[model samples]
Target: MGKSKVYFTNMHATIKENLPQKLRRLIKTAGIGQIDFDRKFTAIKIHFGEPGNLAYLRPNYAKTVADVVKELGGKPFLTDCNTLYVGGRKNALDHLSSAYVNGFSLLSTGCHIIIADGLKGTDEALVPVKNGEYVKEAKIGQAVMDADVFISLSHFKGHESTGFGGTLKNIGMGCGSRAGKMEMHSSGKPHVSHSKCVGCGTCIKNCAHDAITLKDHKATIDHNKCVGCGRCIGVCPMDAVQPASDESNDILNKKIAEYSAAVLYGRPNFHISLVIDVSPYCDCHSENDIPIVPDVGMFASFDPVALDVACADAVNRQSVIKGSILEKNGHKHQDYFTDVSPETNWRVAIDHAVKLNLGNKEYELITI
Candidate 1:
């Protein structure tokens, strides 16, 4: 296959012309309107940053995409799955409230919002994709599967786990329902610690699998039956549950690749990544740190894998902003995220994504 088209524009103007108009121009140039959005349910997967995380994509940008979808006669909804390791977005109710607080209200984006996973985080559909590495199927959010079209409005940034989070990250991790997340993170088990367990029964109440119990002055998970869904890890007020053992970073990266493939199997998808506020960690955190690099710009593509690769390449090319967490000063030969999180390799994710035939590793970047 030839080079994948990845269109971009720098963050030069103010939000008025810079966002809405630029989105239209970029997509039009890239032939995004050709997709059959007419009278379809279009899901625009996006991360509404946690309450204190300022690094997420702004609501105005999502509004631009939502408006464009409406113009094409699609009923657009801003969405994201309930997170696996949660601070705010563990369940649909709390997740929606977080979205509103983070400025993803219907009035802001001109569309409704839905947590892909329903109230208990167990509402999901198992899609059969017998890809070689995966045996039978991958469980994606039912609402996501029901949508006629898919779009990802990703906030491109560094992640402690993944080398950098981008369009593919937005799809693979963002579209996974709570159980899907558990499957991807299966190797890493989390158990409740009795000493820290408040015995308030919050963990038991929130657990979808009924894996946890409050008795004998503490909490216990029947590991023989524990599916390791990771919901209880986030629900404990006293921080009782934590990962039992850290899996090799390589395993985590590869799992992300496989999950990304499951999300895109049969969807008519398009993606847009905003490379702004290049934070050092995931927006799932309740707080965000200073950006390690200046805002680069925006990118759009039909290929999620290529889009992420292009964005990561763009970020790697920029010089790290001093006085931030990026401790390295060698612009000639430094990987920014790696400099910050030394144990992990982001390239593994890219290579694995390509290996799984998600998209080509070689991408040609075009500036709009």
Candidate 2:
């Protein structure tokens, strides 16, 4: 429970060593080799840029992580769960297609991609969260739980909801099953966006609980019968079924911490976050805006919580980019994430994560 070690390396690279080589060295020095990866299935969780979000970490970073795993005699594969929203990554087929379109092919990343939540986002494993107040059981992607070792290659950036999407966000929300994401973001049920609903019977056909019925060529969800499994939200062709994002920002952060506990508890896990392209919104968005701050560098740690804090500190230390949202917001809160996103306080997640015994908030930032 002392100050955890967070190793960092700046973005300055020379002809002798490129960025990827630098990343490899950073992770190695961060004690990634301490894990016993001999013939184990290692899951390198990452976001494959939402098709057009150029701010997402490039596949080269993933290749570096995967190659290190392979060199350690581990079977490594890049994995991410299907998104809850209707997007290019709502199902396994579309998800894989989007990943390929974003240049994450095995040919490019030197590893295969697995949509952890399966075709319809129902392939899940129920995991119990220890000392959890917000969530007792976390519905996680089955493939993620099946892995023997876990590694997060995250793009540390701004988020509209939780402030910053870092290591915990990548593991908790990114690895969540469709239903898991629902539990974190909402009251566990989806409502039909009447304007967007074409009365497409897709949700009706896919609802196992028969909670959906078409009325006047529009889908109406029967809250009484709804199980809050969030299948309707995923299968809606027009993206008509929407999550009721009613959870408070603080509660949302706590739920993320609990979900993260479900994934990392009793497991060998490592984390790496790239503090470049500090966009003001999540990579889940199809488009990315200009970075709010200059690219800091890369960070690695055994402690996901500490890694996140270190990254946030590094970002806050840098001057805001001119014309960026952070500058426009005027730094009223003196915190970059909250300044960019006034409604969200990223520290809620950090404090909740610390309370959950995830890792120490205090960290020694070691620049290499």
Best by TM-score: 2
Evaluate residue 209 in candidate 1 and report its C-alpha lDDT on the 0 to 100 scale. 75
TM-scores, each model vs. reference: 0.91, 0.98
TM-score of 2: 0.98
The residue ranges of model 1 lying beyond 4 angstroms of the native Cα positions read: 14-16, 132-136, 200-215, 230-245, 328-333
Residue 140 C-alpha lDDT in model 2: 97
Per-residue lDDT of candidate 2, residues 1-368 (tens digit): 68999999999999999999999999999999999999999999999889877898889999999999999999999999999886788899999999998889899989899989899899999999999998999999999999999999999999999999999999999999999999999865789899999986999998888889999999999999998888887778788888888899889999999999999999799999999999999999999999999999999999999999999989999998999988888897878998888899889999999999999999999989
Q: Supply the global lDDT for candidate 1.
A: 0.79
**Candidate 1's residue-wise lDDT over 224-299, tens digit each?**
6677666676556686776554556666677677777777777688888889999988888899888888889888
lDDT of 2: 0.93
Runs in model 2 deviating more than 4 A are none
Best by lDDT: 2
